[model samples]
Target: MTMPAFALDYLPLGAPDFSKIKETDYLPAFEKAIKQNREEVNKIVANKAKPTFENTVLAYEKSGVELDRVSNVFFALVSAHKTPVIAETEKKVMPMLTELQNEISFNKELFKKVKYVYDHQLKKLKGEDKRLTEELYKSFVRSGALLSDEKMERMKQINLRIADLQQEWGTLLPNATNNSVIWVNSKEELAGLSEADIAQCKKDAESRGGYTPYAIVIVNTTQQAILSSLDNRNLRRRVYEASRHRADGTRQFNTFPLVVEIAKLRAEMGELMGYNNYASYSLEKTMAKNSDNVYNFLKQLIAEYTPKAQAETKAIEDYAKKQMGTDFKLQPYDRFYYSAKMKQEMLNISDDEVKPYFNIDSVIVNGVFYAAHRVYGLNFVQRTDIPTYHPDMKVYEVHDKDGKLLALFYSDPYRRPTKRGGAWMSAFAKQSGLRQQLPIIYNVTNYAKAPEGQPTLITWDEVTTLFHEFGHALHGMLSNCKYNTLSGTAVARDFVEMPSQFNETFASIPEIFDHYAKHAVTGEPMPADLKEKMLKSISFQQAYALGENLAATCLDLAWHHLSSKEIPTANEAANFEVEALKKIGLYDEQVPPRYSTSYFNHVWGGGYAAGYYSYLWTDVLACNVAEAFQKFGVLKPETGNAFRQKVLSRGNTKDQMEMFTDFTGMKTPDSSGFLKYRGL
Candidate 1:
């Protein structure tokens, strides 16, 4: 019998040949790739020559190309444009991949070769070679390479269990999100929504074959984006309840048991790793070295934000009473509604007024790509020749200043039942100097799709998100590292977000904003008065935003900081979350934590775990760097080149803080810049 030539085996230079891919191809491709990778590993362990950095470490670095190729494309599709076949494929393939990882992590002969290079040949290496050798050694040790055989086997089982649960939760989470959509019986209940929005909801209902005149789909957050404009209190309550209780209801998708089990397993693993708790073990590799530091940081934020949040809540309540009845009590659903009203009353600005100027296409070509060209001298040309995973996905060819090919970028934007919630950047291929590969990166977002023949106008917040995810893409595209493992966005979790957040500063710049913020139909730039009002509205609800974010971080810490004995059962999870919020003095009836535990995918299903604090932690660094860019000249090539050299292109070859100081001439990360920006 002859085997078929797999799409994973052959591809064009820059992009994955998506047209050649089929769901049935994954399992066989994975099997063949794993075998090839294992054979490659065997060569390293069985080499007759002395274990030099070239013979051992570098060989190991480039060994798993085929496996990496399959996993990258598979996972990217599973998140961005999934189907039932893809979901089922993920459920089957994840365990095989996990087992393979365990085999390599526990390969004692391989560990000996890697350690020999570190112990003997490290000083003889130079630059990224030296850094790669050290990172390889540390990676092995950290993956239980030094554990006794008995403990190693146990660790392997634990890792496999973790992988299984993660795969299961990945499927359940999105289903739960879709299942939680609130169906309305009449159009009168959707009074505050625009006609386009109401029509979209009706279309959603027709597609889902559910009750009624409209369907309000819940995004993967505690508060729905539409909650702000929803005039009916009961309907708002329904949407809020559905979002907050996602994956926690009596349906088959409830994640309560999975949450408890995941936390318990993480606790046990931490104990085995000789750490105090999972948080300690997770934080060991982050800039914040311990749970205590995270706690202290959150406490300071609470002290600063609590009073301001109280004042904001009082003002909102007063406005709510005037709008509703005097006896009406402000609820969680009312927060955004009343806050938007308050912002409008105070500044005469609203999302509706600013959205028309932020058509998605203009924001991308004129706004996002324009800013990139100004700062970095990078160019993005659309490519229709390449195939994409979905019809909606757009591919671009990115070129460096001297017209050198940098990367192939794919953009998949819009929401559907099959696609997951939120926006993110991912790579189908990563850059590597040894193999001489350029990056193949993609950005995925869940912006609501407009009706056919209608423009996809976006809010100001979505405009910032466009810039933010592209910031991450820049990190991947600009990376100039030698080894694949240490390339592009591979820095410490706390440090990885800095580049992306810093790029968000461009969203509000006068030149950048004027370039992109044009009316969808008329192509006119936003009016000066509206632009001024929009910019001033940045700090309108700063305290609540910061407080809720801090609360979520604290909640993540509280769950992971517990000992094995303290891992709560499923029933205690909700109460545990409330108590945790209260303990941090961040509990507010109107402002719930940004994500409650049951649906907090960042900590549970996503890789964040105890690292959710990275957003704020990196914000400190982002502000410092952004301030430097402002002083030096935001659009100057010199400033951009300095940042690329000192930070973005360096990967993890240097300490993150040292890289920041080198770029900005700052002695330490200053939160004052972030505080001033937020008006906190």
Candidate 2:
């Protein structure tokens, strides 16, 4: 009920001086929010009325609105705009956040109230509220709310330790990448790599590895770009192994011990809650419903994608062998080199030739921002008034028709040593009806940093990725919900990805592409012939991209859906993936999972955990949803507004399927749409 007289109070209400952020202020702000949240939680628990959906569930939803607001901004900035002081602050607060979650999930009196209502109150409710009640009840139960005192204590310890390990996992990924070095002796060995990439490798090498060392910085993945492009097999192997063995190596950053501990703790927690595995515990409220549906979905995709994947691998092997004029087994490093080369030969399309048109600024202003403006009657103008934590940050004001303020957008585009490697969209401000708030969204991507004079040209894939992330931002910006938890991107994990992945379709659309695909120096629109090739080029390597992603999804499900006693060890888990992929016939030494087990941030570090399959599941929805637009025209305001109303604005207030049907007028997705888009 109290408001602060600070710049943070109103985002885009005026210019914010971001440089003024102090480490001292966060602890106080965070502590106050936590105390306030607990008070709200107390009101819910101590309410005089018998537990009812409105009194209990909605009260619980409203309880943490302020904390969610403060913590989301604080944590997002901690990761994206980190200083050592802020990082230390994050270290301090994470355990506190973990404890708060434990308090709510393990509240006995609250559980009893919720259970009574769940068993007796459902008949009194109908439609979405009923589903919401059931979901809230099951979440508490699955989180071990009903456990006896002894087991509850153990579950608390396990949950807290897992939270600690997750922090360890995220913190180490960037550390390993920032710390590791691969020194190059000669330019000859770095044959196929671009000068920009080579220069970066050299700078990193000189900084960390070489005698004036030219170390290529590590990315969190099994295969490295230097691995594929470098002619030296030994160097390639070293790079591949370095990236693969990250945090699991014999150094202090090792997470192998932590991984086993987290798994064991999760299983123990599962048993306490009466679930057989973590997936069962985690999936109680997810779109997949339970492990069986999730398993079946993964298996079906594996069966369908494996053959196409294997054939693609065989083609790569054939290319590598003929090029080498000898028989040598293709290893992980050989994959990307051969795949890119093969695409150039087969489709006459190379990313290098395509990259010129996709300079980052053009893609944002002309591509992403333009599409959003045209489709939704919104516009973006850059802001310097708001303070950002970093010099690299760019802020935007998003406005709807009649110049009504809609959202705030920020982007951090170039790679930095402080940043963890990869792309993600997150919120500094989430939309909510409780506070009458609008979204303030931030997206971060770790593209190769442009040198002093170079333009920030991006690969075609990266272009799509930008559009994809912004789609999630759009979902955030457009949200209209009564609760913070249900607003914007707060839907079920399996359904959360639908908006983002669906936005990727716009990146390659003829209308959107032509607007943004201007040459950096020439300022000329991308030639139509080249544009056609680029549009067609998007699908050129579908087999490899599809297979790698599917492998990771399947592997995630397989590892997490285990019976406690059957949980596979890391080595055993890797072998299982090999066999599993082989069974689906996609198993090729040349095509590894997009994320290797050790480095899978989704499960171990990020929120996805057992839920990475959400990407694939949502891809099906994305494919189907694209058809809605194709049928009614891509920029059709009628269709767009309908979807925005039904799906975007509805958030977690209704069943996702109901929302989808409301927009598409169908309960089941058009399955062939997914296949057609993937070239299956």
Candidate 3:
């Protein structure tokens, strides 16, 4: 059988021939890759000699190379450029991949060989070798290797069903979001938005065949960014309601039923594994260690956040009442608009004033890349010869200060109908010294594109997001690990966000900020007073930011913490979410969760399931690291190198906390940094 072009290795590591690859190639490529992987595994199982660290552990680690390569490209496209064909391909391919995983996990002979090395030879191994042995053993146990025959069979079925449900939820939620666009017949309804914004809405409507003259597309989050600028109260309500109910059973593409089923199945899997709930099973290897610890940490923060949030809401309400008569009442849609208005009035800063300085290209080159060069001695040279999956993507060759080719970086920085909302960092190939593979890292964002021939200006929040995603890229690009399994951003969910969040601190630093925050038209730096106002207002809306996030995190926990019997029906999903928020003291009508249950793709579809609190958990770690950088001078190369060595490059080879202590000189990460950073 001839290997598909997509499945073959590229001459330059990690660069796929994207121009030749088609949606039709994915299924065949996956089938061949899986077969190749199974054969490699079979070789290890058939070895007659006694298992050793090299033969058993390393062989298993190296076995699925082709499959991983195919999967990396396939899934990246599915998320970043999902057309109808790609979506259909995902529905067919996911089950086959899941079954392959189960086969590897449940192979009694393979497990015996891996266990033999883990039990007898692990003590002799050192550093990454030992860590790999331990991780491999634990992975087998987590995959039901120790279960009875009946339970193992049942686990296989559960895994298959869960995979299907996750794919369904992932597909349904994004379609629902796209379909929920609010089409306004006239520009009068869009009076509050800027001319550029209004133009973009018109363009969106025209792109969708002009169902209406203007269209407001719903983003992935429960709170849409447009809410902050919209003037008409009724339009704001319409947009907010569209976002809030996008994936409810009432919608054409519903995910409520899928959410309930996934939760119940996860609960059953947890029970089979002898855990109280899915959260317990999931958190066992994370830094938080257990659900109780996560709950306690959230509880501590909630006690402080609730009062601050109440005061914040009261202030916004007071402002709203003054603006519109005394009888005016605040609603969820009013929060962003009033918050922005109050900030503009109080601090004399607005997104409109800040956006001109944040032209998308300048932010990428002069801002994000500049900081990388200053701290990490890295440089990016754009490559036009490389083929990309989309025209919006730009490829760059990343070079170290020593002039050696380090990695390939790709950037996709615009919103499209097919692209999902929010931003993320992923790789077509992860760094591995053993495989001699260089990382091919890409960052995908959903910032609205500018009109033809117009310069793209992004919000300050989006600028921070750009920097945040690059932090994850750096983690992958600078990885020094030998094994692919432990390389790059493959750390604990609770710890992985630390790198990304810590990177955000760089976006506001004066040295870097001045370079990138130039007016798109004039190329002039922002005026000193304007810069001061913008910097001063960084902590302006901490209550809403923290409140929405905590509500979502708590909502994630509420679903996963339930036993099988406690799982709600599809009809009760909304009520369950309301009660969950109320129980956690996060039930504010004016400040909903960053994601509601029905449209909470992060929990349901994204791998976050019970792990959404990781953003808060790692924010603490990130702030602590940020404080350390401040102590050492934020742009100091010495501090950056130390972090790259201690954290980013280390990957999962060392203990996560130990890596933190090694760099920060603190045994425990300080929670005070989080409070100080958020201005609570």
Candidate 4:
């Protein structure tokens, strides 16, 4: 297969044959791009001109365009469309890529050029250019440019193992999702589920040869959708056990051993870098600043949430007994179902009541896209010209009010057997001044596919999810940066979730709710009563929601905090997690960590790793940001524009804290905003 001049595999890679390449084009392109990078590096080293900002640092930044353009496609496919071929290709390429990174990090000539420009350019530059230079120099030092050759070799091996294990970690989950679900035959077994759920299950079972009478698929989250329903405690226990243990006890995909090795290796690498643990090493460049800050920040939230979560669980137990007429203890599997039932009885609302208003098209056009237009004066016109990863993916050309092209947005909105679970955003092309390239961004979600001929009715959670992801799209789309490494949504992990999570607020805002929350059949807006109940009910589930998240964060911290001199085995980490939770009064077998280490792709798959607590970290940032909006007003153009210019547009070209300060005039967001939001 020949590649297109700028193949659909990735955004146009320049105007030439770089744009049009086939899978067959990969090895050649990889060779060509790496060779081209080498030549570019050589030119920078050999240039007769003095190492000025323009000649040394800027030129070096621009030099890797070919290499970057090709790898984006290569890696995205490996993550999103993995198959035997892609998997094998990934294994083959991993060592080569890892070595390439090491080579550049250690290159003496390149460092000299970079150092010369940085030392001399600080006084000559302003804003991002100054920040970029500082960042690059700091990066070089941190990446071990000054290390002895032997230590560098050790560092290389540790990093190489990380890359491979991370890949293995990410690869195991999709099939685990496939293998973990149960099949059922009796309608009585489906007692707690809605008619729609039952219909969906029967349809699902029918598709699987009706060979079995009913099928219930367990999604990749700790809380199975079936847990909130399905009357039988036995069934709930079975599903819960399977989900909690999906990656444990199974040698085929078990990540227990991998976790221990990765943690130990990360600690060893960090010790090599003169840091105590991986957390300190990783957070050095991030807004969190140090492991102490991360610990204190999360500990504060835990202190507030622990009491409230306990109360909420107790409340649920009381409700379960009252409603079910049994002393059946409240379990993790029952939390969603009874809480859902209790929500309806107490607040007169359930997800079902809110589902109609957020059918797929309404949510996209009136909710997610509508808010974008209102805030950014952007418009989305769907186009079929773009190639997509899957058929459901919708592409659009976004333009400013002045009709200039702003960015390209693509959304993949349905779940699939092949797709690794969870919602996230990825860049096909990053916006950068060096390359003059606009961001081509994709929002991938795992919402249930709409039944045949049924509009994609979605719950409020799903609606917020769409908004959450598009927040990331806008961050990428709006970025104005000079370096690809510092481009949109490429900031520290703790800060990356700020924008996307911020957007979730809009999904519930009256301005947005009025526009998108409409019944598909009647095309009528959600009734004020129901919408009010929705606002009153689900959002208050904060205790339940935030608890699950906090438990997961605890689980992550426990895994990564292993001492570098000696690391715990997988079983030890698991035991350590239980103890961590117990110390915080969170040791509930019913409520496991949202993901067991054995199958947590977020930490292992991409860049998240021990950084999963970032969601909590940024929730604090975002919650405080919302306070900024409240003080001004949600619709203030001046404040929104300030946020855009300071945070979203600037990317990581500047230090992350500077971006926050520029917008909020604060050195940091306080922890109070998060606790207050959680109603703790």
Could you tell me the lDDT of residue 33 within candidate 2? 83
Give a tens-digit lDDT track for model 4, residues 226-312: 676667888888888788877775777567787778878888878888877777788777777777888887777777877787787
The positional error of residue 569 in candidate 4, measured at the CA in angstroms, is: 1.6
Q: What lDDT does the true structure give each of the candidates?
A: 0.86, 0.77, 0.91, 0.76
lDDT per residue (tens digit) for residues 544-663 in model 3: 889899999999999999999999998898999999999888899988999999888788888898899999999999989988998887888999999999999999999999999999
Q: TM-scores across all candidates?
A: 0.98, 0.92, 0.98, 0.94
User: By the lDDT metric, which is better: model 3 or model 4?
Assistant: 3
Which pairs of residues clash in candidate 2, taking residues 3 or more apart in a chain or in different chains?
15-385, 16-386, 16-387, 18-387, 205-213, 205-214, 205-215, 206-213, 210-213
What are the runs in model 3 whose C-alpha is more than 4 Å off? 1-11, 249-251
Q: Supply the TM-score for candidate 2.
A: 0.92
Task: Report how far residue 561 has shifted in candidate 4, in Å.
Answer: 2.2
Model 2 Cα lDDT, one tens digit per residue, 1-680: 22433324533352234666566678777888888888888888898888888888767766676676667767776667666777778888889988998998988988888888889888898755676677788778777777888988888888889888887777776776665566677777777777877787776665564664366777755666555356677777877777766656655766655566666677666667788888788887787789888777767776677677777777778898988866677787777777777777877777778788889999999999998877777789898778787788899999986799888899998777677777889887677766677778889987876777878888877898899999999999888776666678878898899999999988877788889899988989988787777677677657777777877876776667666677666546556667766765556666678886667888877888788988988898888888888888898777778778888877787878878788777787655557568766
Model 2's C-alpha root-mean-square deviation from the true structure amounts to 2.9
After superposition, candidate 2 runs with Cα above 4 Å error: 1-17, 46-58, 112-135, 206-213, 225-234, 568-586
Could you give me the TM-score of model 3 versus the true structure? 0.98
What lDDT is reached at residue 117 by model 3? 93
